[model samples]
Target chain A: MKREQGAARGLAQRMGIPGPMGGAHMELNGNREAVVEGCGGILEYSEESVRVRTGKLAVRFVGRGLRIKCLAADSLVVEGFFTGIEFLW
Target chain B: MLAGLARWLLGSVTFSVFPQGGRRGAGERFFSLAARSGASLWGVRRRGEAFSASVRAGQYAGLRAPARRAGVRLRVSRRNGLPFWLRACRRRKGLVAGGALAAALLLWMPSCIWSVNVAGVSGPQAQELLAQAELLGLFPGVPRGDIDPDLLQQSLMRRYPDAGWISVNTRGSVATITLSERVETPPVKESGRYYNVKAARAGQVVSIHATEGEAAVSPGDAVAEGQLLISGVWEDVYGASHLSHAAGEVLARTQRTAEAEVPLRQTIREPTGETVERRSLRVFSLQFPLTAVPAPQEGYSCTARVETLSFGGVSLPVSLYIERWEGFQEREVVLTEEEAAAQAWREIQAQTDAWEGVELLRAEERAAVQGGVYRLQVQYTGLENIAVESEIFTGGGDEMTGDSNVG
Candidate 1:
């Protein structure tokens, strides 16, 4: 399965496809807020941290005053003073 | 900010969720279900076992299934935004009607011309100009867009030939007409025509200087009013008549008499140190009195000033009327004989100074007191120029003779 996925990704890149990994995409706006597109669902939420499930990994946001400003079907907005973003596969 | 505005325009509802059924990770499950159902949420807050958020009003009903499956109960605590306001307005028809009327009036007021102002003109000519403007379809209550300023100016110039220059300017709802009348210069007569230099006033001729024509009087001559001082006609050695306009100066001593009087005993007013002020407002032609204080019975002097409202260089009918009163008491004043005499002399001196064609070279004053009043008389004597221009009649003759030495 891993080899097949790697081959598929290589094919997508050759075909000029963008974000073809079927995983979440993170966009940071001035380190004050972040928008995560293609997120699966929320796993944990707190004032200082928010953990969400992406396709093949878990994305964690560590920050101060962290809160989910917006949550939609395919995207979520996080607002705070962000310290770091980490992915656990 | 755009996102917030979008939410406001689309209408948003806030609801609180309380976790129940002792479910593990109920808050996370609730979010997962809401995301799966494609519902958007914003301004999420969590405290202990309760969570709150806002969602679009259309998505609020569908949120219940997700909240129930996640073992959380939802309660919509607040409803706001434009959708709610419109819903409330639908029930109150009078408010909506009044709002519509006010909006209509505001839009219509500035489109109609409220006043026509005519500047740089006055008197009968101004009235005629305004009448012409009215005939040209420019007047109060006419729609502003229907009047063309350039066309109006062209028409005015055509209608009033005497207008040297004319212009029309419109500002807001007021139209202003600026114009100037033609200035005509009098024609100058040919020097060959005959004219007599006459005495402008009754005076003793102190000196005579003739630049043209023949002198009719000598130095120290007494000339009566309208008397000819220079002759505009002369005869050659062969007895042939000649004609010309006379020009000369005749200086003379003129006398003027002036008299004044003052009373020895007079009535004066002393201020009682009391004052009152009253103000009122006028709208259109209706007067509304605003003061509550009663009128004072004591002697008082009242002064009033009315200030009208002006907008865009045009005065409106509304005005503020203000009246101020100063109270005073009557007192009898007795003047000494010398004081009364001096007062009478001062009054006569003022009148003598104002006399035309004369200066106060000398004055004689006489005063007598009768019935507590002074009777005064004065005579002022001074030297003055007494030359005037008088056109000589031709009498249909090419040669004219004039009277000489008429002083």
Candidate 2:
């Protein structure tokens, strides 16, 4: 009976976890952290911590030191910053 | 300080512009006029030392320097440039080259056949003279500069006595052999040996009128082939005196007999109407036929067949005139007396026409029957016995008298 119950649990765990091709559904379930640099009108990422910098007027500057959630069973948070010359709040 | 120095260098040049060569005479005047026109029209002036000065942007922008030291170098720039002829031919380079060619032609025109015209001569004589002249190389294309024309003419005259005159005329760059050849008559070649009148064809003599020879056969005399009808000499009954020979026609009735056993029933499919066509004729050097046939052969319709007779590049005085009797049936028929007489007379007349100028007497025809076929006999006698004559020329290209196939 114990062996039978252990096998059922293994199947449930496998079903819950997504493979490499699956998107952010397999994330921490709450807040995402990424920083990228905007250069020549493009926002691109860095490795240590994604840093986004709008070097020229090609794009708007976004994101400063916002911390993402790492606690809770499915904790998740989105951090975003955008500054357009013309404000559209 | 260096930039200031460059500035000073540039400023110094901008002030005073100098032209090296002094302008003089017509060529300089023309150059000045062209330059002035260019400047006035487009404000184009002296280009600076820089290569870019020739460009539109360089011309429009202020120059860094006033002028460069490039001077116009002349390649045979005549004090009066290329002669008036060249200057006049500003447009037609071909004409200039052609003029040079024409001048060379003027220099070179003394050679080639410009006008191979033969004047003062008519018919065959003119043509004969031209061939002789061509062989002599006295006509056009002969180098006029090298030869003494008068002496050349005299030599040619001696060679071709048939030519009344020959002259050379040069126009710009063309040489002409203006020839005037005299009309010539057929040479009468006298054999000097008097011949007896023998029967050319087998015939019976019906009548005789001896002109100069002794009549050997009387009227109604049957003479065999080659038997003498009249002897060239007369012999006395005693054979005492040897007499002189005479050159005259012996009138004797010579019968030319033609016998035929023609089939009687003949289906002669002849056309009811006839079509005749005539055309203009030319034989190179000569204009037309010297036979002097009046216009077209009218009355009895005939099919026209005109032919031009030419010998090499030289055209003859005579032409092949053929009367193509249209689609007429060449019917075979048993001829009656009248038809037979007409046919015989026509054949005899044709033979007579061959020697038209010579005096020949013709006799009335006689008819007879032999072997179920009637025979028609006609007779003729020559009035004047003419002898053929000829002379050998050195440069005429014809072989010497005894060397030709024709007698």
Candidate 3:
């Protein structure tokens, strides 16, 4: 019971706390990210399943199921339909 | 329409790919697709100046949490496969247009009633005429396309008898009314004969009127049956001999009084309503024929007519009519004073109306009652004199001509 309480406290402190790795990064407006396949990243990604920091967004054929808390970068993760996604100036 | 979509598709490429945001650009395009969609495809043409210029705006209502789900963006037409926006703000023209619109909004709205209107024609008191016309509950800003011009003209004409012409027109936010006045014509001068009206039965004249020809008797005149009480022939003391083929005059009354009796030798009237409905049909140029029509069944007589045929608006090769008459009862009619007065007036009308042989000029009636029996006298002028002058007054007699309204 004591060990579980210590782990939870550590997780709360680390909420949205960026690791000291990226170069001068600023918080985005809380929008979701979708990464392209075959791109260099610190996470596994595809058109359906994605890992953002430690949070995972995956859509399967059946019921609601999840594998979360896994991601890195400012890219978006998409699932259902696609053609062109955004305009970057 | 396909070409338009192609152009937009080509244009969207530029706005799609730069500084990509959450892949939401895909979502925004989907929303726009939904908004501007239908079985009807839209095509735009820019010939010389564009027909319309508008600031396009759209919204995406698909998401409940819009803050969390940013609307997707579209790829725009850009150079060398880049996001559509220009590298730098290049021109101030768009800003200038916006600023001008803002300034105009701050200034006065340039709209007002430029003028009051009258329709069909204008009268002497045009302003007053418009006021009277407005009483019909019509006003400016009423769409001309929606109104029936003839009906509106008729309504306005009724209120302004003096007007000859009236028109309505609108420009921008103002409406204008225009009008012209009617020309007046003097009545014809009548110089003709008069006939004496004897009493058909004892009764007082309820009314006496002289429209054009001379009146031989006045209202409230009481005379014995067959006595000369009303006359149409009037003479000047000089007694200069004057001639008139068919001079103007027509008169009638609503009532006269007389006593009626049984076995007093009443008029059988042939038990037939002898009404002649004459119709003419054109066979060719300047030719008219009275043709035969279908006969009626037994117990009835028909005055069948066949004129010229009509094809569309033009007269055709033939025209005809079919008439049938049924039996009518000729029962004894016991007339009171009111009936006698009415019958006397009706005779006066018969004397002063249009006729085939001699022109009707003036009519007068006299009445007397005795022993529950009424007697009546009907006298008419021009009935004898018009026969003396044939070919003096003969024409097509269409209403378009000045002599059209002759009685």
Highest-scoring model, DockQ: 1
Q: After superposition, how far is residue B61 of candidate 2 from its true place, in Å?
A: 35
lDDT of each: 0.82, 0.40, 0.37
Give candidate 3's error at residue B251 in angstroms: 29
The deviation in Å at residue B201 for candidate 2 is 4.4
> Which stretches of model 2 miss by more than 4 angstroms?
A1-89, B1-95, B120-202, B206-213, B232-243, B246-249, B257-407
User: Which 10 successive residues of model 1 chain B have the least lDDT summed?
Assistant: B398-407
Model 1, residue B358: distance off in Å is 4.7
TM-score of candidate 1 to 2 decimals: 0.55
If ranked by DockQ, best first, what sequence of candidates would result? 1, 3, 2
For model 2, residues B325-376, the per-residue Cα lDDT tens digits are 4445456566675665555567656666675444445555566655534455
TM-scores for every predicted model? 0.55, 0.29, 0.21
Instruction: Report residue B204 deviation for candidate 2 (angstroms).
Output: 3.5
- What is the DockQ for all candidates, taken in turn? 0.53, 0.00, 0.01
Candidate 1 lDDT over residue span B1-407, tens digit each: 89888878888999998889767579877987897898999888777668888999889999889988898989999987889888999999999999999999789868977667778887666767778998998876788899999999999999878778899998897788999877787868675566778898898888988777788888877879988888777667998767677888788888777877788889999999899988888764457888987767669998887676888668564678888899999999999988887888788768866877665588776778888888887776787778887777655657333444322
Which is the winner by DockQ between candidate 1 and candidate 2? 1
Of candidate 3 chain B, the 10-residue stretch with the lowest lDDT total is B38-47
lDDT of predicted model 3: 0.37
**Backbone clashes in model 1, listed as residue pairs:** none
